[model samples]
Target: MMQRNVGVVFGGVSPEHEVSIISALQAAAALDRARYRPVPIYIAKDGVWYTGDDRLLDPAAYRDLDRIRREATPVMLDPRSYRTLELVAAGGRRFARPARWSVDVLLLGLHGGPGENGGLQGLCEAFNVPYTGSGILGSALGMDKVLSKMLCRDQQIPIVDFVAFRESDWGYHEEAWLDRCEQELGYPVVVKPARLGSSIGISRAADRAALDAAIEEALRYDEKVVVERAVTALREINCSVLGDVHEAIPSVLEEPVRSAGQELLSFREKYLRGGGADGGKHARRPAKQPAGAEGMASLDRVIPAPLPPEKTAEIQALGVRIFQLFECSGVARIDFLMDGTTGQVYFNEINTIPGSFSFYLWEPTGVSFTDLTHRLIDLALKQHHDKNGRVRTYDVNLLSERSLQGLKGAKQRAG
Candidate 1:
């Protein structure tokens, strides 16, 4: 009914920082101005948070970080107030106090690092702010590849055989770790950082040499690494689930198109290429559009993935299960690795805050980007209300004068 200000928080000190920017800007562009006013809350790579005018909505304007910082107003979240962001003083305000702004809800567009890995979500909780997407536990669990697989395994959800190890486990014992991998999971393994997405630190290892190299690369991004037996004749199918654990729905399936000889979808293939052309009307682009302007929307993929009706339903059901399992709110894209040779599907990983919010997949389902954004904001507000409705504090004061006198008497008796 009434207009609400939604703070679209994005950008972070992460390998996927640029991708986050693209996703956030797309979401800001799609917000229904009639129902919600989109506020830009940008977290720079340096970890400083900023807020600014319409310049924040221009994707091209992000090429120069220094210019953005110069023009943007740096701000910090004040947990003392409900959803208040206080401006940090830069120039002499002389006698004037710093300004503050409030948002009805926070639309999280962050991808990796603290932004999506529970840190920002926790900050929102501390600020008592309503935010979209997963909560602290859900975000933490979804970001962790090892934990996601373990939970899936415990639940009997099919997952590829994986050997998870921390950097400490391989310290000066590379031979032992190599032997373990060679014995348990043989060659042609996929190595990935345990907590990162956008395929930033992922590689396919064919031999011991490549495996070693892959592990080292993965360690650069995260202390933990996951080496899984590569699915033969792999077909990556993704399904996006929207809403919360209580009531959620799955969108149409998507099979991301990979390039020939590309063992895994590199960051380039995922974002750099022009994919909007194949994405239907909302994803269609101009002939002279900039490279990678579409973000994940630009990645070439088949929507409603030419799967049999049964298979489509199976994947969608699985997607919903995984979404509820992770206690995820808002929209998340659950990826499944299907063995083309056997048609066996294995739960791969979950994107808690998927790029472009997987709008392409939902578009065919009759959910426009604007409508999707609206749903997410509404969900955020409802969740906040539900969370705060419960009793959080006690009326009794433990440190009252009577209680203090009793403590003093106990001390005297002990003496």
Candidate 2:
């Protein structure tokens, strides 16, 4: 049996570049060699694509961007050929041409911006390639924090009250808008860019002065910004969901314990210090059994959580529901914020392509990363088959012999 060629694309012009590389390399290393051949495709910050042996499985090598570019062959998605990604190279002495490589599936590891926010998905659609993760609509919806929250509210998924405003609107009536935010959400609000991740442009404001500064900071990242009431004394719980829109399975919940003084998990805290001393890069572990009931014990968490069984079930069911609501396929990590005292969970956000692909969460459930990757590849192929089965074009010549005599008479009369 021939192994399917899987193109795992990662690294991009997003702030999450380093994290994406880590996630992609992990996936590439864990892919079952017997069932699939993992091809490393790197997208540089300059927007150039590359593929080759040198680009394989090592996060540290990416630090020297220029070196990687020189070593790897430039590649691009071939819009003309379905399920094919071409490698463009300078012509040899006798022939002035380029080379190409056809891939079976695209496993996207790029996070944020064009990668996670539908740009790449749109390209995949145009190229008729089966890529893992969400479709265009789901990717777009999931990336836009404001829109996703709106959808969640309509679907009765628990979400915090938020006010979304455009920069143009803020420019026109800054005072009026600020007044509305204060009146509606009050102080100590969380301000964030409408469509970014990794806590890039997220801030917590305890007062009007801070709120003003936070909004200014968020505007640098996006045109739209969302201001929401901060969950004081909150516990952040994350759950990974697998499968497609129709049916999904939830991983055990993880409680990201932050420092006592930290109001929110900043980018520095999440990727820098490693969620704290007991929960950094090497210190981190995956979730385990009894399902969501145990919380995330091994990985600096309580596993299944210390919450009641009913609460655990509610969070798990909501996780699956949110996955379907966003029309997400493959795998995604949906984060929730629970009031420490009340134990009420609110939909926080969804990571379409979570870091490390959330394999650690699945490991506890007896699913290895290799098996998880295979499942994603299988799902992608199944979706491709289902799409191909649909009739996309019809054999009709509408312009062949249209009678214009009657239409001309009608037009003349109208004139």
Candidate 3:
């Protein structure tokens, strides 16, 4: 079998920058060495791109990003070629020549910002390259909390009532917005940056004061903010959906264990305190667990979340529906909020490019990390081919002199 170069792209100018790095590195490490060659395409916090040898694979090497930037060869995507990367400094040296690296497909590990929110996906589409995960519309919808909830609500999918506002909207009518939330959603509500993930700018507000503060904090991260009625007896159940709209399946559910007195899953709890976090190396681990970190997989979670068969089936079915509704390709993790007291589930948010690719959830279902990546790459290639098979462009020369004779301002435009 011929080996394919898989560009594992990650890291971006978002609060989840470090988290994205961890996710990408974990993915690169998991790719089947014999079938695929992983190419490190690291997007720096400053928006520069770089690609290098296996040295970029080491997690510890990221501690000094400045050093990595200096050592790595800067590169950028070639818009003219399909799945090709051109070295930024290709011909800078007198004796050196320009070079391009061709990739079979892109395995996106990006979690937040432009990388995950349709920016990179749109670029890939323009370049005519095969890339994993959702396309432009799906990626955009998945990233926006307000839009996703609205879509779910429109489709009769249960979702907690939420009030969305922009920074400008809140600027002059802060009190009105506060009064609206207090009246409609009640006292306790969860405030989050509409387009961010990894719980970076998320907070649970129990009163008007906290709600006000939470909104302000969230606004610092994003222009738009969403405040949802908080679930008092919240149980976060995440289901991973694999493949595209045509044929997709959900993995076994996972219930992440939250610490006592923790109203929401803190960034520390989700990544730092877990057995697999970079900083949690010395932190105590849950009994019966093996050693080593695995990005989100390192977090302590109960696989096959202790739910009844019917409940599991319902959530899994919902996951697949949402995946298809959003026209998502490759893999995505759809998170849900279940009222432990009422046994009701509500659509929370979807991670189009979930951390660790949510492979741990699939592991229990007989899918290994390598297998998950293989399926994603295969799906990407198939989607690309299917898309190209359609009629995309017209062969008519609409801009020719003969055709432009009747057009107004044609000479001005041409000049």
Please list the Cα RMSD from the true structure of every candidate, rounded to 1 decimal place. 3.5, 5.3, 3.7
Candidate 3, residue 132: Cα displacement in angstroms equals 0.6
Candidate 2 lDDT, tens digit per residue, 1-415? 8888788899998988777876777787778889787777888988887777633556557667788777677775565566565545432322112366667899998889899999998988888888898899999999999999999999888889888999999997888888989999997899999999988999998888888899999999999999999987799888899999878999987777675788887666565563432444334332221111111221344454567778878888999999998999999999999988888899999989887788878877888888888888888888988998899777664333453344676555656
Tens-place lDDT per residue, model 3, 175-261, is 999999999899689999999988988999999899999999999999999999998799999999998888999999999888899
* Model 1: residues with Cα > 4 Å off, grouped in runs: 83-98, 275-292, 403-415
lDDT of 1 at 329: 97
Candidate 3 runs further than 4 Å off: 83-98, 274-293, 401-415
Q: Write the per-residue lDDT of candidate 1 for residues 297-334, one digit (tens) a residue.
A: 87778887888999999999999999999999999999
- TM-score winner between candidates 2 and 3: 3
In what order do the candidates fall by lDDT, top score first? 1, 3, 2
> Candidate 3: lDDT of 130?
88
The TM-score values for the models, in the order shown, are 0.92, 0.89, 0.91
Q: Rank the candidates by TM-score, best first.
A: 1, 3, 2
Model with the higher lDDT, candidate 1 or 3:
1
Please give the range of 10 consecutive residues that has the lowest summed lDDT in model 1. 89-98
